[model samples]
Target chain A: MSQKILTRMGDGERLAMDAQEIRDDIRRGTAEAARRAGVPELTEAEQEELFAILAEPGRIVSVEPGREVIVTDDGCSMSFYSGQDGGGVGAPLSRLQAVLTYERACGADTTSMGHSDYSYKPVKPIINFEANDYYNISQVTTAPFLYGAQPNMGLYFQPDGPCANAAELMPLGKIDEARAAQEEACEHLRRDLVFVGRRLAEVGLEGLNFDTCGSAGDADYLAALQAVEELKKDLPDLPIIMGGAGEFVLGMHGGVEYQGRRLAGLYPHEQVKVAEAAGVDIYGVAVSTATTESVAWNLARAVTFVKAASEASSIPVHANVGMGVCGVPMMEQPPIDAVTRVSKALVQIGKADGL
Target chain B: MSEALFQASVDAVVRGDAKKAEELARQGLAEGIEPLVLINQAFVPGINQVGEMFGAGKLFLPELIMSAKAMQAATDIINAAIPEGNAQEGRGRFVIGTVEGDVHDIGKTIVVALLKANGFEVLDLGRDVPTDRLIEEADKFNAHIIGTSALLTTTMPAQQKLEEALKKAGLKGRFKTMVGGAPVTERWAKKIGADGFAEDAGAAVVVAKQLLATN
Candidate 1:
């Protein structure tokens, strides 16, 4: 269930909590703890205390069928929807929800679903991050109406833990088990999409974006794509967006000569031919300057890839920055500025309308 | 003749044929080729090349996995034939795992393979390992370095917890600490008292080696 907790108190009243304020408090707490440790590092005790403060959102004061009020022990109460936003689960999703709500308030046109680094939460069972699943949608109930933007669910295909460890285990002749795990993951992706689609519709979400790190074999990719195609039948109203690195997408289509070298992938034009045939609504090209030595070069490269994808696809195309190259807590004081610059360039130069 | 056989062993791994790689190792043994030669000259070189191909996007996970299997098949046979302590000589013992509350292990698994390929005696504790488990394993293995990977920003603090746990247990400075993951930054590592942080597998191997130097 999605539930929001009131964290801070105002002048004898509760104020609407802000994601940035929460982050700032955590950062300041960590820094102060580090300073008190006298070694420029936070002690484990201090670290745990900080994380607890970050993760804990106080206690429930009142509860109804769909909404509730959660009050900190300090007497500050935050009213939230218990069933819509992931209120009681923990701080990660709640914090992310607050951020998305803030972004919508700031006139952002698109609310990209999923976290920067995507992992299938149920498949691994170890990752408990907030940007995890559709059930976390209670946090963004008003995004569609607020921003006039369709919510996009960015589905991650890679499975971690034993499933991902299959690659390592295979070298030791442990193929069957890992292969079965991989297959199980594909099946999970297949089955979950339908449930996720139904749940998103309940929350009024309208778009589906496919995302993968491109480590899976061709068979795994095929299985995921087939699952997607099947889900499309059920949710034909939802537009689908195909997203990944340029090389992997092109390779899946055919082969392409990149930088005078024939890589094992199709050229941009040829790739779009396959995408259009598969009924892709939009093509998202991951453009990053992580490999480039300078900011100007990175922007230039981002523009080049975005333009290429826009021209290649008959449908709308968008840009995903670096495809998880940059680390998390990305929407912050500094990185947010970079995101603003790059996003503007993407829309202006690439002739893209959304991100 | 021995050089030709060793070269064939490399080819077997590059081609990702487990049966062929195992057969070549047995063949080299029968032909009186040094087991060390089979590992250093044949298996290591092939896996290294595979890592390069993977980084460059020329190779996918399937091929990389197959090559690792080929390399392992040969390495297992050669390791069994060689003296136990001899195989570990000149290599530092490294223990790694994903911290508690985070189960992401793909990146950690890659780092393990690269560390093993680079001559480190790597003990992968797998994902969702608690701080106590890591500490216990490090003690059991007499590890020179302990590493943690946390893919979620929420779990990233566990790295710091592990560091603090080490200090509380009087094990601080006894083992070098390394932290990494998609959400991990160099600043975070420094704040948490980590000896090193790597962005990916290749950089991880380099950082692990550098940490060993300081340790």
Candidate 2:
């Protein structure tokens, strides 16, 4: 790892969450839901609100549509606090297949609004808010507009290769052609962060999902955080959902090599904590199918992490086991037995533990 | 007896033991394994297992891909050694590809294996195939079935383009066309005038067979 990539192996003893914890939390959620008399699973809207309470149970918030949010064809505008998910609203996405498709749909058709007053609807949609995750809020806010299968400029100008390393990124470093390629990539992300910030700020978002960055180590992480910061500047109320480094680091990297823990190496817990300390609306880890199931142990560890992060963070945390990993898609076709077992265990253990 | 060897071959392929899979297949051959017997017994069940596992999520894309490769290895040996006039000889020629802009192919690969296993001579065009080229290939091969897959919502239009190109080229009735993918509903396939449609690989062969007979 680069010196520039600072890590915080802090004594926060907040070490990683375990499978049992996740199973317990899941059970708790089920029991709580059962007591409520057939609310069934929590909706995406409800989960976001629950996270807000978890992130800072001290404050009040919501995720449903409301007066503070302004919807439009160009974009949606919101000015309310947001948190992350609570449960399986859309069949948990860890892969790009589901995420990319859903993100596109959410961006195209969805909008939100909210305030402390809470007028139109009872509780506002509790969207997750991660503020300190990047430098430019605008780039992240506008990211959806530029990316996805939808006809955004990112695709329009993109030269058809890796989104993170397209030659189209070169213009950002016009002044320094030698490092122009790298700088261009940075610039593109920075712009996307700003876009994300702008759109989200409209929804009172100072945070991000942090799942799609596809980066690791300090530099990539810092660049990502810097982009968040930039967006936060324009939208000061931003929050963040930090380091969804599912699959791999979710179990402390490769579990066995590190004595049945995620490798303490290069994982960015310290940076995320720093963001949390800075009053990020949300801060916690996340896992995906790839992160959770590269080994059977991963699936077990992921349940633990989801439980831990959900309860631990002052902000809402959740898991996203979408449909694909890198290119090897999975979510749509996990074994029936695995789904049954995982779901049962999560409800029995991870959910019951109250983390 | 051949059925037992075929079943063993499928088990070996699933376990990722290539040597074992090949040995079982060779054993079936020495026992005078009929191509169709091997296909129906070992290959179809094996690929069907892929479908079941995929549906259940026990296996992911890589596993599907790996199994397809494994099945192909076994198919090459089995198809060649068997006589040509076998009743189950797969001569219902089909050309398949992913629609433009969508590179996802795990679904298509399974369909390819099943199609070949079913005694259909399949021309797999791989992923992100353009519309015109798809039409060109089907016309070139005089294929009985022209298949298209679009995993992304945006690229689904290519399926329609394939249909239109065939109509424009006067090859409309020449090939029975089918389209598939996660987002591709059969209603959409019908709306776009596809001869057939399937949500998964196993059903694709069934649909392809029905489409060929209908055409």
Candidate 3:
């Protein structure tokens, strides 16, 4: 009911502020709701900084070339957007700079180029454009590069990047060109993966993560899976974590509805199926808590969805829970308690799944 | 043969083949089937089945959207055959869009399809639409209801701004305003002074009809 704090901020500033504020709000509300619902909340320290728990020192297993390594520690991960979280393409500038800053402020086990950072733009690779200099580092690195957490880099490989409209991706030119366009998209992604991987490895990065839910259809989704598999072939030692939809919103804070009924917005199970085929180490369900129902209610719903996903899959499952309201024409950060409750529920589900 | 043509029309939509659905519609028209009857018999039933299957989780988004697209294609062909002056009186006009600063449109698109299927004439303004533009379009279309969707907290304020803009333009009560999206709760709709709020696309139709009755 409060006037949105976002209305007063500049475009980029408002996006970052809104995302953080909504996150803060969800965290706060979820914490309180957990108390009422008899669900445990994150510890104060964990609440203060999530990556502290995620970035705990673990023995590094050497990843041999041409052999794939499974990431046992999925770790508590947060998926962010560049413009919304600050930094990246369409944002103020260097997303890696912002990532380092964020890690310094809040410990981060994984450095991910939020969906906004790598939204596929035709004829341009945002990663190369944004993180041009730090693509590769000369020495192997460990934790505390920018923050308290050990660093692992994650980027997105959307078949149709969130920025690229699906209609545009629909083949319009000559038949062969359209076929070539699809192949070109897959090739571009394969190259992007290799490019980012080599660049991060040069800087001593330990692992890789892929958020692959925004793209539609079996073909695009399967293509993304193949790209991940191909990338793994090239970097067998790097622990690869794959993310897809767990439910309707995929926690992207975008509208995902069909008919009067709310459809599972993303193909979580299908994505996991391909990911399993691709030998992805960890599968993440990105469920947003921005439903019209109470955050507790949505968390409960997410529990059911994640449980089904975990039960149906052979891999370790993690829930990328966030507070994104997709129904309202506009919204602000959800209460912080809501975020914590969803986090707690995710943690519960993760444990139940034996992750 | 008539039954076969109608069944094929239904099959085309269920299969989400837009070209085939359009083709079947043309074939049905050539066979002297009434346009409205084709819509009522085949198009409506096809979309309804899609809705049922989708609700039951047998069908997912790709199929659901394709079916909707197929329905639209058939509807377009049917509408073109009907004379312009043959208007259905009392069916409400609904103008809908995703609020500015939020470019997500799946929810709005679904709502548009549902509205059209339920007999409302719609002007879908697409996504990231400005508040003023929605009001402008609503007025231009003489809409009975203006539905706004916002997918992000950052863009949600635009819904409130739209409500305020309508009041400022002294046209607040002229159109019934409904607000929805991922973050929108009934409480937020009430806070924003919206006339109605539906949690999802199905409820939207029921609520839109209710709002029209009172209006």
Best by TM-score: 1
TM-score for each prediction?
Answer: 0.63, 0.46, 0.61
lDDT (10s digit) by residue, model 2, range B1-215: 66567778778667545566666667777877676677668866776776565443345333444565566667777777777675443458999998888765545755775565455777887777888888878879879888999866567888998888888888888888898876575557778998887866667877887887776
lDDT of 1 by residue, A1-355 (tens): 3344343221112233344444444345334322322213333453333333323443322122432111101000001111211112223334345435444555444344443233333422322332244435535544331101111111232333223445446434465655555555555555554444445555545555555423343333443355456767777776666654433331211122323333333323334445555566665555322321222224434444445556656776656553232110221122433344444445555445345
Q: What is the lDDT of every predicted structure here?
A: 0.54, 0.46, 0.54
Query: lDDT of candidate 2?
Result: 0.46
* RMSD from true fold, candidate 3: 11.9
lDDT of 1 by residue, B32-132 (tens): 77888778887777877877766544554545566766777787788788876776345689999999988666667667766765567888887789999
lDDT of 2 by residue, A48-103 (tens): 33322223222222222431211121112221121111112344332333323433
Worst lDDT window (10 residues) for model 1 chain B?
Answer: B55-64
Provide i-RMS per model in Å.
10.1, 15.8, 9.0
For model 3, residues B80-133, the per-residue Cα lDDT tens digits are 888778743466999998888776665676677667655678888777788889
- Minimal lDDT window, size 10, model 2 chain A: A5-14
What is the Å distance of residue A65 in model 3 from its true position?
38
Docking quality (DockQ) for each candidate: 0.13, 0.02, 0.15
1 or 2: which has the higher DockQ?
A: 1
Q: What is the TM-score of chain B in candidate 1?
A: 0.78
